[model samples]
Target: MTTDPREAGPRPPFPGEQQQERPGLTSKMTPAPDHGETSYVGKGLLTDRVALITGGDSGIGRAVSIAYAREGADVAISYLDAEQSDAEETARWVEQAGRRALLLPGDLRDEDHCRALVARTVAELGRIDILVNNAAAQTINDGLDDVTAHDLEGAFRANVFAMYYLAQAAVPHMRPGSAIVNSTSQQAKVADSTMLIYAATKGAIASLTIGLSNLLAPKGIRVNCVAPGPIWTPIQPIAKTPEQIEQLGADTPLGRAGQPAELAPAYVLLASREGSYMSGALVPVTGGTPMY
Candidate 1:
């Protein structure tokens, strides 16, 4: 497995330590994830296609957004209002690839806003060819007792519910051969006690990807998911302790956390014509987590 020197070593606090909200920024990360290195060249795989990615402001979402743009797809990134700067930065990079980027900022928790997200993307880009359900929320807790109704609902809304809402809105507009990619987590399979609620939501997302794939197959729209293991993203600081963040993905077989750029290629494959036969599948970019 090829590894980058920048992502190798004792992890530092994600760049700017501004503890503002659930989803944070790549620009603010201590070591900014490589959105696209010069080695990643455009191949026009998704030429003339349009893509809408939730949480595209940072982390895996940003990586996927940049990859799609480089692959010849116009990109639209949906993020929270607080992440405007990060979202715009992603847009600039997407545009740098000679593709148009629509910056759609709003709360995915709102059903109406979720619908509007797809509408705006389609309106701006002409049509929606790819929909990436990647936005998610999580918080560490002691155990089941620590998991409250609000906490579960918030995680579900951000992680699973909005995925459903966004897919429902985008599917009709998607023509034959369109693709939808959801982001599940390794925790969904080997969940720790501290992340029970968050894991449950991701588990649902894995199932959702399967069911949606079957439902949309007749329409020629493929649906799949990328189950990431411990990745070094802003979510670590917001959801886990500083000490926990320090150890990030050390327990994995890779003995280190994954960078967002590493996972983006999986998304690119699923979103492009290359994955036309792939549907109802979960591709584990989990550092050898052994999903089976």
Candidate 2:
């Protein structure tokens, strides 16, 4: 039960984390990132509730799906149509834990699709007690000249617009005590030049989280965010170069990339009754990097 923190998860120098697409798959990576398949014991903290998780096909979404299921919440996972294989695998894990898993695939950039994601979850899963806005888009740039209008627009649509659309659609269906957990990033505060679009959108998400928390407080809905440092997710492979991927998370004081498994508990806590008094709180699981 006691493992060295420095050696908790896989370090950098990972081979072939890159994929030829925007949203990468989990199966392609060489030392597949752990999603707590054999780990993550639950305590029935979310018995009979339903959760809708964006980007639940892989990475942190997959991990959160597993944790939510094990904790007794039926989960509806959303992802791109291209990620059907990964979605099915994630659904299997949720079902293995004796909870229902709904696979909804579409583009989050569309407002109607974002609304549909909420409607489908409420209609199929009975109700949406939790909404996890975990899906986002990121791309690297050498300089301002390299940042294209299309990429910038797409990033804002997926990362920022989608959150607003989903929240608007989900709020009416949710009852008191429901929770919404958004996944922002450490890049929001620390600022990465190469990730201009990503950092900007993430910063918007952080601000939105605070405003949404207050907006929903009267209804007893909690809104919070998790700002993760460099993690060993498919996003790394797709967005960074081999050199950057190799040294990923090494700069963290912990000396390694955080695993998908490591981020799930925070989501669970935010959605559970234990976090009843917590709202608008941004919890940073950044290895040892300072978020504030």
Candidate 3:
């Protein structure tokens, strides 16, 4: 039986009535998200590769971990300390895919930790073939008055600084044909007033991707990015109020929020050999949200 992509799963609960501590757990979500546990089938597209993904404990990161494992890559997942439980779940899925799974728990906001993350992944997994900078943090702000110096600095530290730290550390170990996929957001292009800081960081990430691609091309390394739209993830409960969550993705042309599972294939494609010739590109998985 064939299924329409738009009608594949029940629309997520409007307003996600339940909320969890920041970096929420999948086990606590009202309707559990689909991470392609039973749906995605891999044909060894990334056989024998090693991947290091930040924020791999949940949301789009978890989905990417599962996809990479299924595609024959060992996964090293790094997440916040509070997300150990969620990280373990992601590791479980990766191991179930008949690949090695390493769980690194720490805050990526620290430059030292970011360096250590890369070192550990290389030490444990042998080498890093795919580096995914996916972890990010943001606070809701109504306007410039609501934004604090602490909030501004914190967002950049977590979102952009860590990416640079990880890249610097990982690049030395990365050989030709390696890929780096940074996670940007649709907000990078279509700025949201309330998400000013977060949007700015994403824009920085996009610029970094392009510039890095140019700088790394001579070394045969590819740098690219994925700009996701409103995807149902743990961040929603913490970032959006119940009322706002209720109307999530309503303005998107697709008329619904995307699931983490829906965003994994794009990462997989970009990381695989198929994307060897593709670099300095922004692949939008924004559910019809135009990047322009």
Candidate 4:
């Protein structure tokens, strides 16, 4: 079966009034984003491995959880307590994939909580072979004046600082050949003013991934990042206006928003043995959008 890439998934202008408050839910999405529920077919690429994915409750995190589980890795997910329902749903998918799933709910803004997520994953899942730093906090702003100090701190804490917090605690426990994959964004280079703070943090993550890869390379641990283009996930409705939601991913070269399922294979490649020589790499899965 052959399908055209541009029309492989849903295209815009999307239907209905898609809008929600912070920390949105998949159930609220009109067509509902696909997390590889019936699409991804694992080939035991990560068998016997254990993975810890932050923000694994939904969106890209959820999709990765399902893919990793099917690839034969036990999965642990970290999420804010408010998203427990979504988190449980993700756990279900992992379990259905015939792998273990651990749910850790807490705010990643706290360094202690970030460290604890790694600790608990190691304790319950046996060991962490892949750490996916996919959780993030994004807020749309009008301009510099609309951004506040607290807003900046919140974004950095959850998006950048927490990656360090978890890495610091997990690396020692991880063995050689382990990998750390992060989620940056196309906006990191494309530079969107409306999402200024969010884009800034994503840029910082890309830098950190490179520097961290160098620091961990000698230990035989690889680090990489994925810069996503416009993807359909709960994060869109939560952070964007209803108007923006309707036109989501309409500007992409592919002519449609990438789904969370579309982003999973990239995470899998970076975290699996197939990507052994891929450290410090920034893999772009932006629906043909360019990233420099």
Candidate 5:
């Protein structure tokens, strides 16, 4: 999705672009991320499919849940205990779309929790046609010496490793035509000074997406990813300071941050039959950021 500079409204100044902080939560963002409630008009691309989305409680995940439901799919949302009210709110939105919503809460850092997340979704929804590995964590540090081993492991477990754990459990229940959409980041390609660890995890996610697409090709399961630039979401508030938050995504050619709603369409397109012929691809929704 592209944001025009003339339409960017007022943007506040922030710190150096190279800094990284925390993975902000949705509740405290300056202007909360749009969950795509009003604009999306579903075309039944995912009719009768069951979608399991990790971190579906907010941000892009919540937007995708609503979009999928509007397309005639039942949804099962998995979230960490960090946010309960948001999860309930997201479920309500899904239900409002006339689709069943199941809430599964747990820590994805644990392999068992990851496995159970998919198992429960299948037990409740019968079969899983869409699995979104969107849950992740990141703690900003100065540089390599500042990154603790624990921090590295934590980021990996939540960002990239959990995808493997959850996919291993969910793939068995998936048949032909199922899709897996992993959330990568612009940092995967454009590295920042403080976000080295976080960027590394996202880079790993990109690699995993390509590898999984090949591994599951024979089984008719498609794997693709959306590498989003800065979209206004909770993760920003938690990860970056208020000043940094104010300037989010301004460095891009568009000179403004993106909204979660703007990024939702990419996930919808990838998960739905509209993108059936596409696989092993990375779709950049980074507001005119150069990727080559």
Candidate 6:
């Protein structure tokens, strides 16, 4: 039977579920996310390139990794050790696409590990032509009073600090045509009250992308960011209460949550030669929500 691609639509009401940990696994998500496994067609846009992506085990990161491999780039995916199974699954897809897939499992919060990850990717893959700093951490708090110092620090460490660490390590190996894509969020501009810390880190990432673009442009490197709107990923069930999950993405102008597959094209565009002139640009895939 032929499958209909358009049949995958906005998620139905989730029955209030939560993962026991942060950055939930893709294997456990209900009606598993679409990472363009059977869809994305490649025309060798990234032929002979090497890419290193953090948080590549699932969600948007996984989607981008798959797309990159299909586009002819060897991909090195880094993810938390707990998500090893998911990361391996992503590597399988890359291998299926006739590209090399390297799995680097570690915590990005550690500066040394971040540096090691870049070094290891270069050692294994030869050189870094693309870097996607897509890993992030988020937790919902009732209010500012409920926010703790640990929560604030953890968010920044995972979302912002890791980006800085990876970029610093990767830049030396990145040639003039190399690209760095950071994953910002719609919250970077909209600012959700319960997720203040997470939103703040994303705001910082947006600024970092612009600033890095200016700093790296002289060396022929491009830095840009993607500010995703409400996309259905494992982060939601873990970050939101069950009731919140049911209403997830309802407030968007499109009246639905986006799929992970929907975000890969933007990353692909930014990493491809087509986007050679695009730097310091913030591409929003927020289902019609204006970033301004």
Per-residue CA lDDT of model 5 for 107-128, tens digit only, reads 8899999999888888988889
Q: Which scores better on TM-score, 2 or 5?
A: 2
- Whichever of 4 and 6 has more TM-score, that candidate is 4
* TM-score of candidate 4 against the unseen true structure: 0.98
Lowest lDDT sum, 10 consecutive residues, model 2, at: 13-22
| Candidate 2 lDDT tens digits, 6-45 | 8888877677436547678888886789999989999999
Model 1 segments beyond 4 Å from truth? 1-21, 37-39
Tell me the alpha-carbon RMSD of every candidate: 2.5, 1.0, 1.2, 0.9, 3.0, 2.1
Least lDDT summed over 10 consecutive residues: which range in candidate 6? 1-10
Residue 37 lDDT (model 4):
94
lDDT, residue 218, model 2: 97
Candidate 4: global Cα-lDDT?
Answer: 0.92
Q: Show model 3 residue runs off by greater than 4 Å.
A: 12-15
Each candidate's clash count:
3, 0, 0, 0, 7, 1
Off by over 4 Å in 2: 16-19
Kindly state the number of residue pairs that clash in model 4.
Answer: 0
Candidate 6, position 125, lDDT: 90
Top candidate by lDDT: 2
TM-score, each model? 0.93, 0.98, 0.97, 0.98, 0.93, 0.96
lDDT of every model, 2 decimals = 0.83, 0.93, 0.90, 0.92, 0.84, 0.90
Clashes of 3: 0
The stretch of ten residues in a row with the least summed lDDT in candidate 1 is: 9-18
Cα RMSD for predicted model 4: 0.9
* Residue pairs clashing, model 5: 22-239, 24-234, 24-235, 24-238, 24-239, 25-234, 26-234
Preferred candidate (lDDT higher): 1 or 3 = 3
Error of 6 at 154 (Å): 1.3
lDDT by residue (1-292, candidate 1, tens digit) is: 2355434433443333344355665555555555554546768888989999998988888888888889899998999998898888889889998999999898899999999999998787899999999988976789668878888788888888899999889988999999999999887798878888888888999999999998999999999999998886678767766567666777777677787777888999999888989999999998766786
